[model samples]
Target: MLKQKAGTRSPDLTVVEMRRALAQRIKLLAEKPGEHPTAIPGLSLYHRTTPTPCFRASYEPGLSIFVQGRKRILLGGTEYLCDDSSFLLSSIDVPAQSQILEASEKTPLLSIFLRLDLPTVREVLSRDDIPESPPSTHRQGLVAGETTVGLIGAVMRMLELLDTPEDIPFLGALAHREILYRILRTPQAERLRAIATSGDLGQRTARAISWLRENYAKPLHMEDLASTARMGVSTLHHQFRALTAMSPLQYQKQLRLQTARQRMLMDGLDATTAAYEVGYESVSQFSREYSRFFGLPPIRDVKALKNSNTALVSVA
Candidate 1:
């Protein structure tokens, strides 16, 4: 028999305690006055304040878990939202935008992001020791699922590495692997299952998705690209849209615009030049498209980014 809460269905008490513990650990991490640490070696830690709105962007394949706030992401046209009780995963390189919907200064948003390694994910799927269920639901690139005690325990174990940096190099990898294993066994495992195999239609579409991610500015020969993935043009057109909620061309366009924005913000590329480098033949067309996607013209957006950095420097 299971114990029921005052207003909710019965679940294991151990599961409830584990989920609460994960949230507590995350809260403590957020209180630390520095950049949030990441599981990935290359990427810097990231934490933020204020409610942000979704803007066209590229989100690398990763796990995004929140403890105190809620966020909604727009992947192509499909929307996925998660809060304290839920978390999200993306198994493929994806173009999307995300915004924090709930946050405050006192108890600001606390999030943990883990990089996704396709090779590792594939290895896990191929292992005979672990079992993954057959997928039946329509697949989307992003998925949100209810948090579980096993998953929360894995997350807590991951954070426990912060104090023992020496152990992290070896132990962290194991813990991270455990977290992925937990996800693979979760109810939403179907999404990851789809991305894990090369034989499935969804997996084939992901192959083409990865291509656009690395070569966003390259001129696309749709038929040739489809051939590269061993998919026909018509089949690619249909399944790709079903998985990502956008056509290949539309995905590339968003990728180009987001890249141009990043170049301007980080590399000081001027609007027109950045536009040209992103495969835009007409400066006017580029400007119009950029403005439409970002809600600001290139010059204004870049200027605002500079000003924000300046303010941060002034405070520090």
Candidate 2:
């Protein structure tokens, strides 16, 4: 929840109106109670009828705007809550746990997700007219901010494309760029600027993260990761933790565990085989860590997950 001080101003009424309008539009488009793709590339719409139990997933860089109800996302120990008044943005790919906190049959959770185009972000930064924001290691890659009329308007136009699919090829890209421009003008601009700028801490950390993602099944070396990121080991450790909220090894562990779970659930691999495929040397060690991370051993967890018939609407 947003804090309200004695003299603090209340939210603007225009934002409330925009939120309602977006919610109504989504309700019309998303007749089913789950995530659905729109005509525009990299855009997804979501609707949910009830509060949900927490579920874990990896989210790539994107902006999630909730229109009707509230949702909470947990990244490491950080909590990001989004509702009609606010939006959440992830500037880098990050593993997170999320839950729907407020929704009902009459007023379900409605949301739109716009995947960030890093190339376009870099192109926007390259324009000489745009002001340069100084880079900082303290910048967090995941954040939530109050919605603006301009941002909401851009999203509204993007969603409007669903009504006229013929104009999507020519107009959708322009509308997406406009949305990125609006976000680049916000206070979080520097955080994103750092991610796209070459040689910056954000870029360096991003490279390291990419490497870990691709080679998660292989044994990791701290020095090798630092070298790949073009930073000293100490600097890499500090900046990586500041951006991602975890050490390099911890990040790899999460990737491995998540992948192993996916293999078992999706491919029907046995627990021991899945563990080995994900680089676990010992089955006992794999079971212990898996249990610690997922709250159950592999077999039992997979069974429970398969038995549950609930459908979760999420954005990545």
Candidate 3:
């Protein structure tokens, strides 16, 4: 697990005010205690009345800010605990397990997900006034950082625009850019920089990830993936694992399982059919892997997931 930053400043009065405003805005915008789409594009609000189960889901490239409760996100064997004082950012698509750890009927877990825009990030990076590139670090795609007053204020502004639909067209994009700028100024900036740079090792590894996502049903070939990434096999493996916290093969397995699970749960595909559809050759192997990943047999797991009271809605 990543250690929390030492000597980090506690929330000041401004930050406290921002957090309170964010919580109130989310509560107002969220019609009920569930996820809801926001007026601004790429923004989603989640309101939970109680603690949640450890839900295994794929986290896309985005930012999640907690304003009222806490969440524990498990990536690989590492667990990141984030609450009202911090924020979580995922610069690339990753399979992660997350659960709302602190909430109640009185003060539910109120959070917001802001889908990061790569194009806007690149636009911000292109400016000559942008800060000099920091030394490269082999950080994982998922990160937790202290939430600054600026970031929360920007989010509050975006939420404030919800009541004025006409202003969203004019001000939403600017607010989004400001949010990105605030993120770029944080320690999370280096990871975002790696993704934004065109020829960096991180970006090349991202290409391989993209290919796997689009062609997960196809057999994985290391040489082909390396060739696609324009890197040597050894470098590809090293950088891919460093950026994603999993080897290429392991990453592909996650994609396969997640895709298969979604197929079974949402599309009502049977275990055998979903397995083959997701490129699993052996039914037994698929079942074993599925059981390990999802904690139950395919049929049973889907039944439990559907029957669960937890509601997650992603506008992205």
List residue ranges in candidate 3 displaced over 4 A.
4-7, 136-138, 310-316
Candidate 3 local lDDT, 14-113, one digit each (tens) = 8788788878888888858777877789899988777778876677788888888877887765677887877888888877777778988888888899
RMSD in angstroms, candidate 3? 2.1
Where does candidate 1 clash, by residue pair? none
Per-residue lDDT tens digits for candidate 1, residues 1-316, read 2111112335578866776666667666666533565544522233455666555545566777665566677665566766666667776766666666776766566667787776777878788977757655646677776677777788787788877888878987788788889988876778887877769887888889888878878899998889877889999999888777788998899878878888888888998899999999988999999888877788997797677552111000
- In model 3, residue pairs whose N, Cα or C atoms come closer than 3 Å (at least 3 residues apart or on different chains), thus clashing, are none
For each candidate in turn, the TM-score is 0.86, 0.93, 0.93
User: Which residue pairs does candidate 2 place in steric collision?
Assistant: none
lDDT of each: 0.71, 0.82, 0.82
Cα RMSD for candidate 1? 5.5
Total clashing pairs for each candidate: 0, 0, 0
Q: What lDDT tens digits, residue by residue, belong to model 2 across residues 1-316?
A: 3221111237688877887898899889998888888879999998888887898767788888878888888776677777777777788878878888899888898888889888888887888978766544336578777778898999999998888999999999899888878877776677778888877878999999999999999999999999999999999999888888899999999999989988888889999999999999999999999999989999998888888743322562
lDDT of 1: 0.71
Error of 3 at 21 (Å): 1.2
Q: How many backbone overlaps does candidate 1 show?
A: 0
Number of the top candidate by TM-score?
3
